[model samples]
Target: MKIFYFTGTGNSLYVAKRIGAEVYSIPQMIKEGRYEFEDEAIGFVFPCYGFGMAKMISNYIKKSKFKSNYFFAIMTYGGKSASGLHNMEEIAAKSGIHFNYTNEIMMVDNFLPAFEMESEIKNKSSDEIEKKIVQIEKDISARKNQLIRKGVASDVLSKYVHKIADNVSKNFAYKQIKVNDSCNGCRVCEQVCPANNISVTKTPEFSHHCEACLSCIHHCPQNAMHLKSEKSKARFINPNIQLKEIINANCQVK
Candidate 1:
């Protein structure tokens, strides 16, 4: 099975790894125009952004072609994973791909401002999150035959919300360059950038097509990238993922 993933803070990557399937980053696949899958089953693993799927995933699915008998999607959300699966299923249907399984796993609440400030105190430990992932995997494997149908109310709400989310994601403004004094000009961000937006000369440069996936921001070795906001301090980084892990985990072929 081939698992295509887009991970922010490693939740989606962790889930994809646990599935023990071949994994590829959606950005890399799009860049290379490669969708050859040796396995019969195809899976998409990504984080739930803005109550739906990430724009990058939607764009990739729309542009790329895949040949697979069975399609599956696994979405990981910090808190409630509302309508994300429904939105993915809708996108698959548009592409004439039928999804055989869909699963949602709830991890730590990492959305900075959505929840209370103290909510970070309740963040699940790495071990706890791993346990939940194990259970989700077991459940998916055991119930592979069942299909969860979306209710009419859910379908309508999901479609409306997804449209709104796409608009918001497209218009969202992000800081152009986030630098700190600790930056050593390692250019690691430039190398890992899927969009190739960042180039290292005197400093990291940003161009258009910045998907705001935070791959550059989060993978900075100097811990220098910062969004221009008071809430930037609240931005949580997963200590479990180091620089090498970020590179290896971000792109995998099981």
Candidate 2:
């Protein structure tokens, strides 16, 4: 089995590792244009962005060709998944692939401006989420009922939300990432960025294709990267996810 994913705070990575399948990051796969799967089962694991799938995942699915008997997806959301699964299914259909399973798991909301949770609540919620994921895995193993129907109204609303988010993501000017005086440039942020958006100059520099995935902001070893907002102080990364785990989790072989 092969699981392809794009993770920011590592909720998607956690699920991918637990499945014990070969994993690939969608951004890396898209950039390299390499698609060779020996596994019969193929899966996508990603966070629900803007009530739908991430643009990276959608673009990869649209362009890449794969031969596999089983196709599945496991989407992790901070709150509600909404029409994320539906959007992915639509993409799969366009790609001429049939999805055998689609599942959603609620994880800690790391999107600071939109949603914030108390530390205690976040910890408790993550524990509950892991339990739900275990159940989802069992269901997939048994080949049980997997598809969740989305009503026409829900689909329309989700599409509208996704459109707004896409515009915002593309048009919005991002705040510069600053490293404080207490800095030793370990270059961890540059290494972990899935977009290849960060580089170690005198300090770290952000490239134009910032997915706002915050992998750099969250994984900085020296606590160096910061956004120019008051929320920067309050913003927290999920403690359960480590950068080493994210990297070491089997994605793909070079």
Q: Tell me the TM-score of each prediction against the true structure.
A: 0.80, 0.85
lDDT of 2 at 31: 60
Measured by TM-score, the strongest candidate is: 2
Q: Which stretches of candidate 2 lie over 4 Å from their true place?
A: 120-124, 170-173, 176-183, 228-241, 247-254
What is the Cα-based TM-score of model 2?
A: 0.85
Each candidate's lDDT (Cα)? Answer: 0.67, 0.71
lDDT of 1 by residue, 136-193 (tens): 6775555474355557787677778777766654323234456878888888777655
Instruction: Single out the weakest 10-residue window by summed lDDT for candidate 1.
Output: 168-177
